[model samples]
Target: MLGASTWNADRAQEIVDEHLSLEAPMLPILHALQEEFGYVAPEAAPLLAQALNLSRAEVHGVISFYHDFRHEPAGRHVLKLCRGEACQSMGSEELAEDLFTKLGLDWNRTTRDGELTVEPVYCLGLCASSPAALIDGEPIARLDATTLGEAVDEARGL
Candidate 1:
């Protein structure tokens, strides 16, 4: 996983300022902030709203609407499990439930140790290899409980 800096209002403002010239720049600004800080801090909405002349609600709506935009920092590693129809048909729902139980996490939640966060992603474009997952952005296809558990354990450095 890429290292992300702690949230800094000044740095966030710099990011927002850098993207302001772009047409329809809200998404870019949000992405930039996430890239720099690993998540969009709640404090960012007011700053972005002021910079873009938008309402805080408008800025927050965009963040909440997008599944990829996290309001809080994720753990050292992120695991995105596919939940698209293809994967569901291939038993991803059951797999996800079992995994969540084993990890003691709900959706989009981090482990107690802060080593990993598990999120649901719709389709990884691996329909042929249904029930796919991505660990820190690296694709892992043809998943099963054992393989997925092993991957998670490895990511957590177990």
Candidate 2:
């Protein structure tokens, strides 16, 4: 399906069983599983549904709803650039375009060297700061082209 070979049946089931036992929010658990594994395996759907007493369609729907859930492995680092109104007002749109052009990649695409994954996020709760971005989950504000480049370099250990 989707030619996305990221899901491992056995691993997905294992993660589902273990994560569901914790009684935490399913979204968080799903996120963790995706983080640990590269993507949420398809087999996780049934297990998650059974554990949460939800329909399989419901579980699938949640996964599909969030942009964060990937059907493929991300590169070594994830660059989540905010596209909220504040960030937009602060020129994030141009900055995003410049970053993509410089990297020769687009949103949800990994670089050829597997060094980075560029993605777009909505509001990161740092709208006031504007032009916020997260490089591997560390949020930073006041972002410009240079700072974004530095963040990418830092994440890649380059």
Candidate 3:
């Protein structure tokens, strides 16, 4: 039961039940939980474990192994920067670091004011337009640090 968060156990149980009939239902169940709750509530691991008759460790492993299943609620805006090789070659790493430095954000952390959350994604399929970002789900490519900062600022409405 996710007592402290916006999520509740009843909803978690509903989501688990809805996906239980599928083969290897864990993935779908996790996805549904994230979609409904903004993140997979930590309380959900036990609920899911009980429903699937799995150990909590197994459920937790899947959540940790997958980058998309955010453990905490994201801020009002999300910045998913590409960290794949192609993007790195185009200076995505440096640009991302600059933004992190400027914003005082670490990987998967929200800002102190809860305005933005930045996470790394292995790929956004924008390799051809390397050095890419998805800011609030809008694609911005061919990024220099200044350009990236500008895009982030724009996306954040700053």
Candidate 4:
């Protein structure tokens, strides 16, 4: 686990060294940090700022702006349900409510078991097949209660 303290000068250089050549530098670095550490430790914001020559606020802003960046730990499986207009038009709101009740969770929150998380995604770009969702990042379309339940069960390895 990369502790927050480890994100100081030395690690800043490491982040820069790894992604400086890339067109969008921070993506890889942040992804690496998040992948290894579970979340980007607060210390990373400043270190990334210095390495990227961006203001600390800018670095923090970027992290906060992206839905993928988690300041805290998340469940092993994240269920991102689409909340876009197309989805909502197709009864996604009702679906979302039912999902929350079934999972005993609210949007952007994790279940008590720490195995599943429920999050709202604006769109999955599968709007034509409205009421889409992603289970552990895999697109699932035409979700109904049974399909959603089965997917959630599968995600939990049940």
Candidate 5:
């Protein structure tokens, strides 16, 4: 997993301040916070709102709207399965369901061992390789349950 630091209000404030000069600082601030802390700390919303002269709701809205912005830290390995029409048509859904069951996880949930977090992505631009997935951002095309399982195991160092 990425070595994200523990949440610190002071550090978060500094990050917000650093980007205050930008024309559109909200996204940058949020990304910075996530980069530092793995996920945007809930406490950050108010700090961002106050710094940017925006409502807390607005800050939160942006956070929630972006699928890439995780509310909680992800597991050591993140498996992003493509769920676009092509992938779905190619049986990604079935493969995903089997993997989810095996891992005892639901979408966006982490495994009990913290080894993996499974997420659904809209597209990976690998339609020709439908049923693709990304393991820690490394694309795996032509995915099957066995291949996906092996990838996850390898990522877990099993």
Candidate 6:
């Protein structure tokens, strides 16, 4: 997770202008916003709507529909666990619960200290080694509690 976005009208306008020329600018604009900010701000919807001549609801829908789009800021380190069928069969569901308990946080929630955030991802294409997870964007296959906890600890600088 990059840091929380510093939401500013000027920055938003600049981003909007940069992508306004694309044939389908919504995705590009949103992606650019996310790239600059950790997630898109709520205010961005209205700005995007005005630029595209669409309703704010339509802009909101597009952002919400994309699983990758984060409405809120993520923690310093993001842990995306696979929830695909292969991983589920390999006990990822159980692992997810275990992590939730260990981290004392549910999916899409950040830790109190904002050191780590746990989120669900459908697949990482690591079926051969199921129960995969991406720790700070680094893919890990055959995930287990011990490894994940260790990584989390490391990520949090514990």
Please report the candidate that would top TM-score against the real structure.
1
Candidate 6 to truth, TM: 0.92
Q: How many clashes in each candidate?
A: 0, 0, 0, 0, 0, 0
Regions of model 2 farther than 4 Å from truth: 1-14, 19-25, 50-55
- Candidate order by decreasing lDDT: 1, 5, 6, 3, 4, 2
Evaluated with lDDT, which candidate comes out highest? 1
Candidate 1 per-residue C-alpha lDDT over 1-158 given as tens digits, one digit per residue, 9 for 90 to 100: 35988989888888988988899999999998899999989999999889989999998898899888888899999999999999999899999999988889988888898889999998889999988999998999899999999998887788
- State in Å the error of residue 53, model 6: 1.3
User: What's model 2's TM-score?
Assistant: 0.80
lDDT of 6 by residue, 91-130 (tens): 9999999989877999899989888889999988899899
**C-alpha RMSD of candidate 2:** 4.3
Q: Relative to the true structure, how large is the alpha-carbon lDDT of every model?
A: 0.90, 0.82, 0.85, 0.82, 0.89, 0.88
Candidate 1 least-lDDT 10 residues: 1-10
Cα deviation in Å at residue 143, candidate 5? 1.1
1 versus 4: better lDDT goes to:
1
Candidate 4 lDDT over 28-60, as tens digits, reads: 888877766667778888788877789999999
- The list of candidate 1 runs beyond 4 A from truth reads none
- Cα lDDT tens digits, model 5, 1-158, are 46778889888988988998899888888888988988887898899889988899998998899987888888988888999999999999999999988888989999888888888999999999889999987999998889989998998899
TM-score of each predicted structure versus truth: 0.93, 0.80, 0.87, 0.83, 0.92, 0.92
Task: Judging by TM-score, tell me the better candidate of 2 and 5.
Answer: 5
lDDT of 2 by residue, 1-158 (tens): 11224556666666667666565569877876786676776767787888789999999999889877776677878889999998999999999999989989988888998878888998899988889998888999998899888988987888
After the best TM-score superposition of candidate 1, give how far the Cα of residue 100 lies from its true spot, in angstroms: 1.7
Q: Which candidate, 2 or 3, has the higher lDDT?
A: 3
